[model samples]
Target: MTIPDRPLEIIWDITYACPLRCVHCYSESGRRPSRQLRRDDLLRMADAIVAMRPYGISIAGGEPLLVKELFEVTERMTAAGIQVALFTGGWTLRPEMVGDLARAFFRVSVSLDGATAEVHDRVRGRRGSFDRALRALDMLAGAGPVFGIDCVVVRSNFGQIEQVCTELVPRFPGLGFVSFGAVVPEGLASRTGFAEHELLTEEQMAAMGAPAFRERLRALVPPGVHVTATDNLALQMHPDRIREGQFFPALQIEPDGAVRAMPAYEGTVGNLLTDSPAELWRRSVERWHDPFVVATLTPVRTVREWAEATRRIDYHFASAADRERIDRRPAFAQL
Candidate 1:
């Protein structure tokens, strides 16, 4: 398929500061990173985003609530007529904050790893995190902005997928959808050596995409609830689509102001603060020509390629020399 002229969506990791240390956090965020883009810089980038006019932008982070100027940023974006989505762990969401978000017409997607407190809290690495998240969901339900649940499917909570869809999701009044993201073994997952233990095996991932399992999930998911799986590439990357070529419709802005074609991939296209969003986006599209990016984007081919890409990308970020190489390469060079 031909690539779109512009991105359909942008996912920005506005800050790398988070309150919770989830076992599978792709950013490995906890305490605020020592280096982050200044508020003025980010606001300036927001201005550029307004100029680009993507259909939607998802503001995310270790915990977006930690950003002191989050509300200000959201208001500016909303006032500019850009649809914004807030992706949070929900630990810091307050009634007043929910009200603000609702007024801005921002959509919220809260993380919920399991159906029950015990299961959820265990993954979040906090004892009462599940309750806090549920409370935030309740507040958002009545606050008026569209909201949904984001669950990272891992070995610990895979069995509760049904309960999350049937029991947990239906209890929230304004819940719009439930997205199941396959746990990617990157970031903290790799650092802690939990990739092998926590991530679903290749066989398990394939099983989740099997016709019978998908039908089971379909039957169990309640009416009015839409279910989406981010890592269900086995079902999405059809052979024909691969042959024809496909493009992912989103770009990501990291907390430090770097723009990347894919969040998990370590290649930086540009910095949102110093570079125009349009130019960065153009580079993101051009970077697709890189063999590494092509392998990362192409799915249902082999688990080994995916694993190696993740490892190499992770290593690229881990090494200063590698990052220097990226900085020196041409804008369209394979990251």
Candidate 2:
């Protein structure tokens, strides 16, 4: 069946509370500042999302499972015919939660940065996190969810991509996709001292771009398993066809209900709690012509350059020194 035309997609960060502290976290999410919208407010935002009729909604978080009434929000979106995708750390995902998630979400993408427990535990900054995540994956597999693994390619785990695709993917029968991307040095990553060493080097990034490496990656995955690379800045350079009811294809809804264009958080179009979805959608479309927005949509040589240019265009997002730091980093530093 063909899908109906709708707005691009929405990445809704339900909360910033997370159990594990990964080095590459873009939002720098943690357990502190346990601030999130009330249940009623979330339902209201869900209603707005339904009204907007986005093609897909990615329910993300510091850890989305930490949010109260998460399944209620998921059910609401699903009931309205919105395709919901859950992006989670899987640290807090328990067996009991698997049934609900399997029924509600169209897909679940869990983070798995390394092949071995030692590598993963160190990357996640928590002991036994790898075991817990593996258990959660087992539960999800048993519960019959269309789940996948998201590996953040970094200096420590870059060599294990083949193992992840060959060994890990086959272990989980429910696994349908494996996504890989280099770490982006933004948010908490920028502040963390270890981010410098964790980021993929210029030589590494160039090697990843080489045709031979790409072919090898494709050859590593088994049949029936899909592999995806998360770096798609070039795809976002062109503005959506406004006349065809397509605006910015994706948006980021913060835990506070503020709606902003994805990958760029300097400007807020509107609040999901206070404004109607139509109004917010209109604002996003209008802002597509804003100088900063236009500049951001323009393509650059590398992802780090794109991010630095994006920050420079928005004075309110970061300071001159921060932009300089970001610019000085290697191209794929903020992948």
Weakest 10 consecutive residues of candidate 2 by summed lDDT: 232-241
TM-score result, candidate 1: 0.84
| Per-model TM-score versus the true fold | 0.84, 0.81
Residue-level lDDT tens digits of model 2 in 28-68: 57734545888898898888878877889999878999987
Clashes by residue pair, model 2:
184-334
Where in model 1 is the C-alpha error above 4 Å? 31-34, 190-192, 210-215, 232-247, 291-300, 317-335
Candidate 1 lDDT over residue span 156-201, tens digit each: 8988988987888878886888888777655554333455467677
TM value for model 2: 0.81
